[model samples]
Target: MSCPFAQSPRSTPNRIPKRSSSERDSIYEVIDAAPLCHVGFTQQEQPFVIPTLHARSGDTLLFHGSTQSRLLQAIASGRPICCVFTLLDGIVAARSAMHHSMNYRSVVAFGTGRLLEDEALRQQAFRLTTEKLLPGRWETCRQPNEAEAKATAIAALMIEEATLKQRSGGPNDIESDLSGPFWAGVLPIQTVIGKPIPADDLPPGVEIPSRIASLTTSG
Candidate 1:
């Protein structure tokens, strides 16, 4: 199905509208690929934007943090929230300086948060957030205890409206600059998983999990 978010002045891009989309799959793709997102909210007439990990459970986005955290408290109060996810793909090198740009995929979502009071639902959010960071990680690590669970808070945001904006391929340069002396091409960027290092206190004979090892090869 197409995106449920209708085009509004706030959600729509005023410039280069061709690069913007409101498609459901496109929006989800960007959100799922991003490792983290910035959540913006206003409290006491002051605005704040905090970066935090997030996960998608169907159309609802999940955020978790310490229950005592100011950001989490603000979010759980049912305040308006704006969440953004971004992935930088490459640096576009154009013949002219003004034509230079970065290739990226980004999403802007509008929602209001609701605290997950039910223990079962909060536990599910924990699992989803963990798996979102590293597949199979939730099963590999020790589960949270009652005290740990109580200390953590999970906030659910039902996406009310959203938009996806993306740019790809080479730079857009003027015709005259195409034959310029400068080299123009994309400097590809990627997120690579490096060798995993064991903890200093890790006991002997302990080995890295297969799922963790696979990230280096897969990336």
Candidate 2:
């Protein structure tokens, strides 16, 4: 079968990437590496965007949430879906207000989601969740019990269409405005890992793992 998330040779009129060419290959790589996504689906004709813990198994996204959430219900009811993940690295400043911008990477995935019912698959999804938060965590922690597994719902979304848009480098001001009096540059921002705060119930000699302690920064 043709790659679902790959660029279409056919015409697209309502597309968002009219100004920039879509980076399809790089986007799939990033989506596979990223840990979470903001998934949006409509409920009663109203919009809803939910920050969800997810895993990308190739082109499929595994999203698990409370069994009773409306978003899950909407997905089950056949609403079209979009999952977005953005990494904002910095703010780009320009000489003029009109040229202000941000240096970032983001992916928008368009797909329809179906609730996953296989018990084994649900357990694997939960395991993927722990691994996403901390590599190698699935083996270290106690596996989910039967009751816990049944209480949660796991859904898989097959990405039918996707795109990536990136804006980087210097300001895009007109030639005449390049020499404007206002200062202009990018103010970079990133995620920093703070010192570990151990759980209150930890024993006196418990220590944090090296894998977690080494996460110095992220975007």
Candidate 3:
């Protein structure tokens, strides 16, 4: 089947010329690698954005929060929302200051969210989100109690339209600018998981799980 995100007007490129990504894999990769996303919505003609943890399931993206949150409440009522995920990979230094920029992967998605009301579906959403943030965590951690589950709100945004824009590699300088004395190169960056820190109240003799232990600077 054709990709649902392909060529939607909201997902089309309008800036940076060729930076708009056409490959669906690139879009999914960006979303999969990001732990947080900025969700934007409108209320009374005013715009607001909030950062929240998200997980992608097929063409849909899911996130949760306290049911009392204004943004979550609005989304639960079928409000249209714009979500953005970004990963900055490095700094590109160029001969000209105007041409200097950063290497990054970014995606913009548009959709209307709905509350997952069924208890079974809500538990599944919770499991998926927990595991996405920290692999294998859902199985190891305590499942939410009835009170906790009732207090939380889970919403899914069916990503009807989205776009992935990214830039990488070294500085792109013209022949004229190449002869300049200014230094031009890319300063690479990465996201690393440091040694796990345990809570002060944790009981002794407990060890880190294999999944959490596997995270590192390279991967």
The ten-residue window of minimal lDDT in model 3 covers: 1-10
**Tens-digit per-residue lDDT, 68-160, candidate 2:** 977676665556788888888799989889889888777777777888888877888888777877777677668888788788888888877
Best candidate (score: TM-score): 1
Error in Å for residue 116 of model 1: 0.2
Error of 3 at 97 (Å): 1.3
Kindly list the per-residue Cα lDDT of model 3 for residues 34-60, writing each as its tens digit: 979999999999999999899888888
In terms of TM-score, how similar is model 3 to the real structure? 0.93
Best by lDDT: 1
Residue pairs whose backbone atoms clash in candidate 1: none
Give residue 102's error in model 3 in angstroms: 0.9
Number of the candidate with higher TM-score, 2 or 3: 3
Model 3 per-residue lDDT at 118: 91
Weakest ten-residue segment in model 1 by summed lDDT = 1-10
Model 2 / residue 82 / CA error / Å: 1.3
Tell me how far the alpha carbon of residue 18 in candidate 2 is from the true structure, in angstroms, after superposition: 7.5
